[model samples]
Target: MNRKNGITVCIIAIIAVVLIYAQSGISFGDPVYQDMDQYFLLNGQVQTGGNNICTDVVFDFRAFDTLGEATVLFTAVMGVIVIFRRLMKGEEYEAE
Candidate 1:
């Protein structure tokens, strides 16, 4: 097969696999452990002293995880900016 047909076949195969996986009995957004959910619902406010349980869980219980996510996002944005800046440096552009 030619390159374009080969690429199209690969993409269709990937999509078919994804559709099959989605149809499987895997559950999304379902908590595996009920005890942890119960503990969070019961003592989340008392331990964190936060009115919003979701906010408390993110900012307090999972602070390090949240920080890591933010760091990764910031690094990705910076890397993209650096790459674009280098690419644009060779071209003439008007600055406002």
Candidate 2:
């Protein structure tokens, strides 16, 4: 490798190592800010009137997000249908 490429790779490796080491305090399956979970577990059923916490979280607290996802998926499907409508109209796809 060229000297310039080697220097760039070394800088990148150092930066990556520093960044990873800096954030090594973060752990999976346990978080720092977790009051929201306790709130949900305690009051999800009472406030949202859902017997299931999973359903309550998905449908009550995150309804707008779920709706947005459904909207995006519907729009994508509609777009694909529009694009392929020509083939649906008595047309044949041929391999060249």
Candidate 3:
């Protein structure tokens, strides 16, 4: 077989192995760790003083994580704009 076909076969084999391993190791409806979930459910409202548990977790428990995600998203958008702006600089546009 050619190099490209060999590479494709290797990739497909890797993906199939990963899928089989994941399916065998993970249970669909049941989860292994419940201690953290129980703790959050019991004390999330008292600690964060938020009526919504989801918001409390996101804003209070994982504030830094959320901020980091937002910063990453903003940086990506700015990078895209800069790249496109540079590419479009040579193009001519009609007056609107």
lDDT of 2 by residue, 1-96 (tens): 999999999999999999999889889789789999999999998999988999998888999988998999999998997788776868774434
User: What lDDT is obtained when candidate 2 is compared to the true structure?
Assistant: 0.90
In TM-score terms, candidate 3 sits at 0.64
TM-score-wise, the better of 1 and 3 is 3
- Score candidate 1 by lDDT: 0.87
- Computed on alpha carbons, the lDDT of every model, listed in order, comes to 0.87, 0.90, 0.87
After superposition, which runs of candidate 2 have C-alpha atoms over 4 Å from their true positions? 1-19, 89-96
Candidate 2's TM-score: 0.65
lDDT against true structure, model 3: 0.87
Q: What TM-score does candidate 1 get on C-alpha atoms?
A: 0.56
Evaluated at residue 82, the lDDT of candidate 1 is 67
- By summed lDDT, which 10 consecutive residues of candidate 3 come out lowest? 87-96
- Number of backbone collisions per candidate: 0, 0, 0
Q: What digit string (tens of lDDT, one per residue) describes model 3 on residues 14-93?
A: 99999998899888878789888787889998998988988888988989999999999999997897677757768753
Q: Sort by lDDT, best first.
A: 2, 3, 1
> Candidate 1: misplaced stretches above 4 Å?
1-32, 88-96
